[model samples]
Target chain A: MEKKFEIKDLITVGVFSALYSIVMFAVACLGFIPILMVFMPLLCPLVAAIPLMLYFSKIKHFGMITITGTLIGILMFIIGHPYPILIFCIGAGLLTEVVLKMGNYQSIKHCVAASAVFSLWFLGMVIAFFFSFRDAYFASILDGYGQEYVDAMKSYTPTWVFFAMIIMCLVGGTVGGLLGAKVLKKHFRKAGMA
Target chain B: MEIGVCSNKNGAFIKLDPRSKLLLLITISIIMIGARTVEVEGVLRLICAAIPLVLLLSIREYKASFIYLLLLGSALICEKHIAPYTHGICNIVLMMICGLITRFVAGYMMGWYTVKSTSVSEFITAMERMHCPSFISIPMSVMFRYFPTLSEEYKSINDAKRMRELGHPFSQPLTYIEYILVPLMMSTVRIADELSAASLSKGLSAGEKRTHICEVSIRPLDVFAITGTMVMFVLFLVY
Candidate 1:
């Protein structure tokens, strides 16, 4: 089979990417609860797993995953994410695509690994905390939320916590991917689609 | 239909190229994101917020622009005057409300204007002209086009669930979520397949330079908008 993305594959990518993004957006709305906002790294990937799994099952070519990532990155930027996050998102997508390629696009194990890596896109959003604006971010948090809240936040988000959040995101993705696979098997596969 | 505001010839007060609209969004987002990190001058913030409202008005989106203005005014007032007086939970809630508004509203309004005012064809043409690979442009356009369809599907699903009395959010929330997602995914796949088939038959896969009837050009207004945004961005950096 030719390894080129046809219009059908591209459109499938588009449709599924849209679904994945909508799921992500819906999950993000939960951030209205102040405490739940901190768990965004986990919640988004976990909740968004279903459509992504469906999208992955349809992937027969190389570029589909990267395209989905880039598309989502642009959407995020449009929705007010910082510009540099785009680069981070594209990198995560590319890395995930490589992981999926290692399994030749079929192995459930690789798909889970890919999901773990793809979840690093959340890292892009929080990356400013580790690198740029570390002081300003906290200062703003202090200003808006008061020193007590900032103290609570800082305690919750120490240097190690960044790595912990990364791990949490990965675990969320891994579990999500597995759950997604099961969902596909229980739903789409029995429907003779997957 | 008359394609978009770009093609509305005699109607729109200020016609902008999609490329320029995209540029304006990037500029506004950059400024607003910066505003969040450091307290920028209030005047600068106001200018940034006003850009989208003015653009919306130019497109004759009177109601949306007015609503945005009202929201911005109220949020500004609450943040400046009322927020300091509140304490504890109310304070945090007030701050959160103000922060979300200041951080997101301007960019969201600008995005709404960009998406609402520009047709998919015009967007694709702009992307193509900017030399974005068709791989990105094609799916991006399709994704843009599909958002409305997705929302429509979601509403119908909600309606169906209500009819069946199968799920409710407060009770059986997980089941309600599952009920919502499973059918949504299935219908999404089916619709995607149908859409792909239709577009393929329309020769979308022919893999040649496609001709579009929507004439997209960088008019003087577009030049002005792009340059003015860049100047503001440079000023933002320097200031």
Candidate 2:
């Protein structure tokens, strides 16, 4: 059987991509708060799950997540995010699509699991931070400020921060998926998104 | 909160073909990311960072350009004076803030410049000419159209919510979710349906060669920008 996507499917993906980018952008802005920076990655996927589930309920098609993810990645890349982050995002999207497909895109368990998988994309930001930004970031600071500053910075920033971020994102994704299911059942389903 | 979509601003960067602009975006991003702590490398990075500002100034976007310049300046100052004394967690937080500003801000500003300047028709035409597959191009074009429409809808929703005095976002979390997200989702679904129907009626998925009125040829400025970016990219690679 030859598979074809209708115009509606493409439009749905496009609209969802916009929604996803806007939400992510809003979350990114919230991350400017120094205190919130660590928590944002953890909380973002949960916040995003609501829309993702709603989008899935409407489409329930294979490859939709991949399409939406790729578009969001391109949008992020165009906006100034590093290329590795884009690659990670698309890879996570593909994984989420596969997870959802295995469950035939219907079960809530699969949806939540898929959201959890999707949230792993946040790891790319951390990876980018360490690989692309860390050394230069510290060096630029040391050069501009002094050695005392660099020493003080190194003492405060434990090496575990990145590992902790990954754990938090996974937890957030799980919680977000559950919340999205609850919302879908209580509101979106009644509102006709389902 | 105005969503910054492309405006019909006349600038040297805006005059270049979208494909060339894309190439510049890639090359500059690589150079910026690969930048080192060495004085010469840092200077090169600074010059690269100034490209967006110069382009914005050429378009007479004085206010926006100034704001961006201010951000860059502040990031430098903060790194010098404030970041060193902050303790463990505070130090990390401060470092991330500075990193966001210094490392990511230029690319972000460049992105804003690109998106705000290039019109949708021009983008679609360029993508088509580049022989990009329809799957990518169609969704991309639709996505471009979607942002402005979504922004418009958000404004209307915000006004309605304000009139009804829905609880503030921070104070009433569930209410905020229920009122704001639900309405937004419903409308989004409706809008998506309508847009798809409208586009289909116009033969968007006809799977035939399409004609566009937008002329998308590369100018000399594009050649110059692309050449400059390529040279810098090669330099970064060598050194």
Per-candidate Cα lDDT values, in order, are 0.81, 0.75
Off by over 4 Å in 2: A79-82, A129-166, B1-14, B81-95
**How do the residues B182-229 of candidate 1 rate in per-residue lDDT, one tens digit apiece?**
999998889889988988887888988888888799999889888888
TM-score for candidate 2: 0.85
The CAPRI-style docking tier of model 1 reads medium
TM-score of each: 0.92, 0.85
- Which predicted model would earn the best DockQ? 1
The DockQ of predicted model 1 stands at: 0.57
Residues B98-197, candidate 2: write the lDDT tens digits: 7667777777777666666677768878898899876777788778767777778888988899899996888997687667777777788898989888
List DockQ, one per candidate, in order.
0.57, 0.44
Candidate 1 regions off by >4 Å? A139-155, B1-10, B36-40
